[model samples]
Target chain A: SQTIHQWPATLVQPVGSPLSLECTVEGTSNPNLYWYRQAAGRGLQLLFYSVGIGQISSEVPQNLSASRPQDRQFILSSKKLLLSDSGFYLCAWSVWEHFGDTEAFFGQGTRLTVV
Target chain B: SQQGEEDPQALSIQEGENATMNCSYKTSINNLQWYRQNSGRGLVHLILIRSNEREKHSGRLRVTLDTSKKSSSLLITASRAADTASYFCATEGNAGGTSYGKLTFGQGTILTVHP
Candidate 1:
């Protein structure tokens, strides 16, 4: 079975501080990885997605960026954190199917609070 | 911009009662998927229904899709307290290209099943 692991379940960061959140999937190769953020009591916003290594697509313009360093390793980074950046960040992975990508599986998520 | 919108931002129901959530989306889709999220946790994929299919069933969950209306509904039967969570609907566009696999999520409906 495939499992996704995300680090730093919760983080408190100062404004303008650098941030790094890592997500890795074991037991799957060449999976599609995504980064989503959910504001308090709001819908999820897709920040970035990668179909392969070194390939990332940004859904909306923002301070955050995403990278897929390996086949199953994805990282979300920011050079400087903003107060608006504080939210629940979720990392998910899905496998490609004949029709499209299959249902996505998510990690526990990283709750970052920028103070 | 968000593509899907779920009705009844919050619902409260007694245990064993049926809970139904509706979602509406814009644009053509390849498939629609439902996900559940416990408080402060990542989402769990519950079910997926292709655009070609009108309805699908899995255990106590039933999903119905209406392409003409560009809407979908998720029905949870005999709900338990454990079923108290936020439910989200995500859509994968039918556009056959790099974007076909990307999922656009809706604002979720929070379901609270009281014991």
Candidate 2:
């Protein structure tokens, strides 16, 4: 069975403060990892995705960045957070296959509120 | 820019009723998937229908896809109060490009089932 773990289910940070959210998955190898953010009443926006270690592709240019330093470990970070950076962050993984039709598994989200 | 859109931004229903949500996308997709998310939580993959398949079912979930219309629908039969959540539709591209493995999501339909 595969499980994804995301830390600090809730966070409150001041504007301009550094931010880091960690996500890791177990029981899967070489899976495609993704980071997404959801607004209060809107759909999700893809932030970053990694096909493998050291390989990252960003979909939106925003205040946040993502890094996959090791397989199954993804980190979302921001050097200086802005008030608009607050949202629900999610981590997801899918099989690294070529068909592009596989389903994704998501982790518990992190709720960040910038105050 | 490839994001999909779900209609009836919010839906309220009673327990033991049926709920239906619709989603439309802009580009060609390899598959369309339905996901459920409780408030401020990670999304759970509910069901998926491929571009070649017209319909799919899992438990209480029924998904229908129309590639000609580039649209999909999710139906929850005999809904329970616990089924209240935001339902989102995501599409994966069949045409590979820089954004090959990423899943594009639509603004979700918020479903609330009351007991």
Candidate 3:
């Protein structure tokens, strides 16, 4: 069984402050990792994804960045936070397989508020 | 982008009643997946239906996919108050060649099952 964990369940940061959110998955190796943000009353917007260590792909360019330093550890960071950066951030992962559907599982998520 | 759109953006139903939500996407897909998210939390995968399959069931969830119509529906039988959450449909992209884990999700349907 694989479980995803995220830290700082709720955060309140001042504008222009730095931000760092961590995510890690246990019981899975080299699983695909993803970062998503959900705006109020909107859909989940993909920000970044990683296939393996040192491999990160950005889906949308914004005030956020993601890094995978280890196979099971992923981090989302920003040098300075913006007001628009406030949202529910989620980390997810799925097994790497070809052809057919591999479902992605999500973590508990972190809610960030920028003032 | 290549996202799906969920119909009946919001649904309210009483407990013990059935709730159905529909999602329509553009282009072809390898599979369609449904997920549920409680307020300010990560999404929980409910079910996945492959393109070749027309239906799937898990617990009280029933999912149906129609390739010709490029749409799918999720039915929750005997809904409970705990089932109140936002439901989203995600589709695996139809890019040629190898398939990456690029999932475009719908705006989502908010379901409120009152007791």
The superposed Cα distance between candidate 2 and the true structure at residue B50, in angstroms, equals 0.6
Best by lDDT: 1
lDDT of 3 by residue, A1-101 (tens): 88999998999999999999999999988899999888888888888988889998998878888899999999999999999999999999998575767
TM-score of chain B of 3: 0.96
- The window of 10 residues in a row where model 3 chain B has the poorest summed lDDT is B93-102
TM-score of chain B of 1: 0.96
The share of true interface contacts that also appear in candidate 3 amounts to 0.58
Q: In model 2, what is the error at residue A79, expressed in angstroms?
A: 0.9
Q: Write the per-residue lDDT of candidate 1 for residues B30-91, one digit (tens) a residue.
A: 89999999999999999999989999999999999999999999999999999999999999
Per-residue lDDT value at B46 in model 1: 96
Q: Compared with the true structure, what per-residue lDDT tens digits does model 2 show for residues B1-115?
A: 4479998799999999999999999888888888999887889988878889998989988899999999999999999999999999999876755444578889999999999
Comparing 1 with 2 on DockQ, the higher-scoring candidate is 1
TM-score of chain B taken alone, every candidate: 0.96, 0.94, 0.96
- Tens-place lDDT digits, model 2, residues A1-114: 999999889999999999999999999999899998888888888889999999988888889889999999999999999999999999999884646468899999999999
**Predicted model with the maximum TM-score:** 1
Indicate the worst ten consecutive residues by lDDT in candidate 2 chain B: B93-102
Q: Would you estimate the TM-scores of all the predictions?
A: 0.97, 0.95, 0.95
Best by DockQ: 3
RMSD of 1: 1.1
